[model samples]
Target: MKLIISYKLDSIENVIPEKQIEIIKLFSYSKSDFIVRKIIEACNLKHPNLEKIPAYNILKNNLNEIINNCLDSIAEKRLVNNQFDMAIIEVVIIDNGHTLIMKLKDNGIGLGENYLHKLSYPEFKHTKSQEHFKKKEKDYCIGGCGIGLFHLNAKLAKNDAKLYLKSRKEAGATIEISMKKPY
Candidate 1:
């Protein structure tokens, strides 16, 4: 149950260095206490941030959503895989002067086709129902409301950010977010 997190940030000149360091440090310190309860072997994070701006708050909130998505992926894997081993999560942050691009990729059982379809629209409700939970009492049930992606999409939209998700059954999934940089 070990989850390794690794990240890369390109072109630091585009972001506020102090904010970037603070955010990464926060993640490194609190990752061990994540609700997923997984061991982390090696984790590296890099990103740029805006200093003393509402943009930082917006991005910070969005980052929390990103973490939720990662946790959801882990929960899905635990439910489907017989023997869930280690998982590696790779995050990339790119600063293009005007925008910040973030991509999160993970090695786990990918999304089901039906699930992926549900994610295409923000209004779609796709969580596993309580009835399904009742049947899964003896099975692995991580208790997800299935609103992670929907909420993520909404968050991105509020910040004029764009999101792209690519998932294949049994293969892993990747989530990419692009947003204008905060001044």
Candidate 2:
């Protein structure tokens, strides 16, 4: 009887872990797309770093999108062409049948105190609060409605997914997006 019980317990443990679904961790902004690439290969024993983005955005296109997102929080924190700083983006992947998870993180001026609740609506204008959202005056920002996060939330819900974001003013922010397999 004890042997049977032990076997049952073992099977239960395995089943629970197996149902974990997916997990992704992103580290920085400069590594935004890079981290996305990393999630694609997280299952491998050795992961290769590939920045194989199409020539359309020229890598600059992606960064521009991120910069635009940042402005919603900072409003006046865009980096100048000469002011060099990389954003942190990390991704962790867990294979759970029809599910995939992606987490993106950045250590830049995060959403302000009032921005947490607004993350579901994570877009704000620099002029809206007399704050600096973009990097600097010289930095060209990407295009966005400042309502990008809303779209993200909608998509996640469609897949019965979860999106988590943590942020603080002048500190940094983290975002986690999980889906039931979006390829």
Candidate 3:
């Protein structure tokens, strides 16, 4: 699947401070299950027939995991002061007759070089350092067992989809998933 148009994360000036705070609060304070429900609801509203699509369960799970990972990254950056005052997560979906593409961009502490290497394999668990895990902060930012991307990649493959990841150490990350439409 060729990505024709790439949308970057919104510029700092374009992000509203109030909305940013609201998003941070929501992610930082709210339960992840609650957040997932909200995300699924939004997706359902946008694609009412999503449940009828082939590999619907896989698609839905992929979307939720990807979004949760993005949110967790943003929350971590906020904790480490690596994120800007206004954080942003931009999700774009496009259906161009033959393929369905979903791209998620976030202004968070991007993946480091070490983490990038582990991301290549589905079996390898990508985890943060001991210090990060020791932090006694909000549960939302703590993230999972470092298997989300691995699972995401495996699931995408099941649906004949591909996952592309691009990131800069301190800048941000962009994840794109594309699969052929089942006609």
Candidate with best lDDT = 3
TM-score of each: 0.62, 0.47, 0.68
Winner on lDDT between 1 and 2 is 1
Writing each residue's lDDT as its tens digit, candidate 3 over 1-183 gives 121211112353354465565554455555244445665666677667666666556767666667667666766676676444555677667777777677778776777666765766746855576666677875534455458787777777877777788887667788877877666
Find the 10 residues in a row with the least total lDDT in model 1: 35-44
In model 2, which range of ten residues has the least summed lDDT? 1-10
Instruction: For each of the candidates, give the backbone clash count.
Output: 0, 32, 0
lDDT of residue 178 for candidate 1: 77
Against the unseen true structure, what C-alpha lDDT does each candidate score?
0.57, 0.41, 0.64
After superposing candidate 1 on the true structure, give the runs of residues whose Cα lies further than 4 Å from its correct spot.
1-56, 120-122, 127-134, 143-145
Give lDDT: candidate 1, residue 41.
14
Rank order by TM-score, top first?
A: 3, 1, 2
Which stretches of candidate 3 lie above 4 Å from their native place? 1-28, 31-49, 82-84, 127-141
Encode model 1's per-residue lDDT on 21-84: one tens digit a residue.
6555554456424422221111113232343334335545556555655655665675666535
lDDT of 2: 0.41
